[model samples]
Target: MFYERFTFRLIFKLLFINALGWLLIYLILKTKLWFTIAGLSFILITSVYTLYSYINQIRSDIKRFILAIKTRDHTLNFKNKSTKGSFPDLYNSFDDIIKTHKDIQLEQDAMFQLIRTILQQVPVGVIVVKDVKDDAEQMEIAFFNEAAATLLNVPAYKYWHRLKQHLPVFTAEIAHIRKGGKRFLELKIQDKLIQLSTEVIPLNLYGADYTIISFQNIKDEIEQKEIEAWNRLIGVISHEILNSITPISSLSDTVNSMVANKEYLNKEDLEDLKPALQTIKRRSEGLLGFVKDYRLIAELPTPELEFHSIGGILQHIHVLMQPFAAAKNIRLQVGQTSSKITVNVDLKLVEQALINLVTNSIYSLEDTENPLIEIDYRLEQNKLFIDVADNGKGIEPEVLEKIFVPFFTTRKNGSGIGLTITRNIMKMHYGSLEVSSVPGEKTIFSLVFNYV
Candidate 1:
């Protein structure tokens, strides 16, 4: 205000002085006019200094605004008191915008923190993948808690790419369930069987599609199932074996008593007695074999761990079974893995289990044009899984559940001890044997060893 008024005063003073000079010129008409020129030069100097000061103030305000933005202080304001003629309203509007954005940012931060807290507290694995919009991709990982990180094996800085490869199989499965709108799925995760549930939602106010996959470990459930199966098996075997043994013992004792009585002996009677004795003997032998099979389960041998390569084992088995398979016109193929893997296992027991599996596979391949048997091994999450698969007329779904039980057979001439003994061997080694079959497609017997 002072500078503006001074400038106005100086202009007026210059006009007055010029008018005075003109008046003098009109009256005196012969002076040099040096005093008027000096006064005008002083005015010009003062105007230049004031203009430089105003320019400096404007520059400083601009620098402050930039600094505020860099420091994330969006609410910072610069209302230039010196900028004259209608600028306050504009500055006020700009400040309002900054305040609004700052408020939004605070709200967003709060929401993220709350979500993070919930995820960290969750017991089950919680995996999240956010959609990347610019590339029109399905999802990327926006957040992963500790449980999720360990479950998915996600490493720092490589999370996005890792998620890209793995999450789709889970997401697609989840999406299918969501289409039906089911809440849960029985799944296998890292050698541990589990049930997983998923929810699709938007993340971070950006409308990125996020999937939350939560999984419950079902290891205990599977253990319970195995226990139930064994309990039922024991009950049936005990009842049936006792029933057969009681009558066989009683008949043998009666035959011995008749043979000892000389007074009742006759040719016709002796002939009938001989047939009866022989029938009893044959039944006794059959019962003994049955008891032997049953006792194998009761007297299971403890496993002695030995390091053995699967490839060598399979190669040896393939050679041993080659002639048998060739006689039956069956082709046995060994699938290769990345490298040779040595596992701590009982060699004899594992071999016996695998032989039973291969035998079962061969028996199932009756009517197929090309009976193909495949033996493959894989390492997932540091667990070794050996799969014996066959292209055969697979077992019916209704009977698939009972295939592992002792003495349960659909075949006419089968003792049904192969798979039962196989399961026992796996149990001794603290491993699992799982059978999956689809009619007319394939039957897979997966022997899993999670020691490593």
Candidate 2:
């Protein structure tokens, strides 16, 4: 519609000027007069100037409209009193387009603000790292929330590349995450334990990869678990002590009554009294041993942390369990994914933990044909893991839950304090003991060590 109206106006102006030119030529030729020539000259010059000015005005108006839109000048009004016919319609269309763009811009800004507010209010820390467009190896911190700044002890405005100077381990871990490495990590930063997770979302914001990392401080959760575990331990200890003490108390009372009635007792009664006395002695000794084990759990020594070879630890464990593995006909093997991998741990303490795990694996393999116990170590995302996996009668789900509780045992004549002590040793070295099992299939126990 706008084009048709513009064409009609152009054609009308051209035809009107052509007719005027024809009339001027006719008068100049027919009259053959000098005065007519001067008059026609003046009229033609005036007509040409008017035509040029009109065309220039239209061109200028169109240019102004485009400039206003390009500069996002919403205050410019295109409605003009001099602009008649279809020109006004063209001007109004331009104004409508500018208004629509402004409305969309406002909506987008509001949505962006809302998203930013939500991210800041979330409990978990959020960090967005974007690769630098100019430097392929460099990365910048595009956005980070208050929680992220506080948890990382970094200014929200600082770029990630600058963190290498003060927080090398953290920076390296983030790089590892961005490279599609490990997805989850539990790290000790300063004195706080943080559980960090990452999600890589490919963003074409500037033709570069970006990663979003979320982390939370899990120290409180761990402390709560420790409290619950202690409560369960207390209950188990109480039950075990009562079981041993109740029998001793009744046997002692029987012996006392038999000795007190010496005049009424026969030879057979004397033999029965002797057996009751021996039973009491055995129960007393058992109670004493139980107390000793409980003391051991309470007095676990602090680890003397140092770098230790993973291969050496596994070799020592393999030798220690050689006899037991042979007796059970279990194939015990030790392997590592890398020979250079090492762990910062207390050699004696970690060795003890590994031995306890291997022994448990050995015991589980009893009565199973062609049982296998594999001890393997691997390094991942700046962390080390020593895994003891066994193909045997796996642990029951109910029993697995209480395996870490002190004195909670599923085995006959088992002390049940071994796993408890092993876990404590791991904790001392700034590591953790994790276990997973499938009944009648397999069991895997992982010793996670933070290498940093």
Each prediction's whole-model lDDT (CA):
0.71, 0.80
Instruction: Judging by TM-score against the true structure, name the best candidate.
Output: 2
lDDT tens readout by residue for model 2, 164-277:
666677767766656443345666778776766544444565566777777766667767987997789779878988988899889988888777946687889878988788
Point out where model 1 deviates above 4 Å: 1-227, 246-264, 337-339, 379-384, 427-430
Provide the TM-score for each candidate, comma-separated. Answer: 0.54, 0.60
Instruction: Name the TM-score of candidate 1.
Output: 0.54
* Local accuracy of candidate 1 as per-residue lDDT tens digits, 1-452: 44465467557756665665565555444546667555655655565565566556656755775676567688576455424422445456556656777888899999989988988777667666555657635346666677766654555222455554665665556665432232445555566555554444334555545555566554577679879987978876776677677777787787777777576788877886877778777777877888887887678688899888888777777777778777789998877633477888888888888888888788889779889999988888646889999989999988987887788888877887888888888877767898888889988998988644
Give per-model CA RMSD: 13.6, 9.0
Off by over 4 Å in 2: 1-112, 123-227, 261-270
Best by lDDT: 2
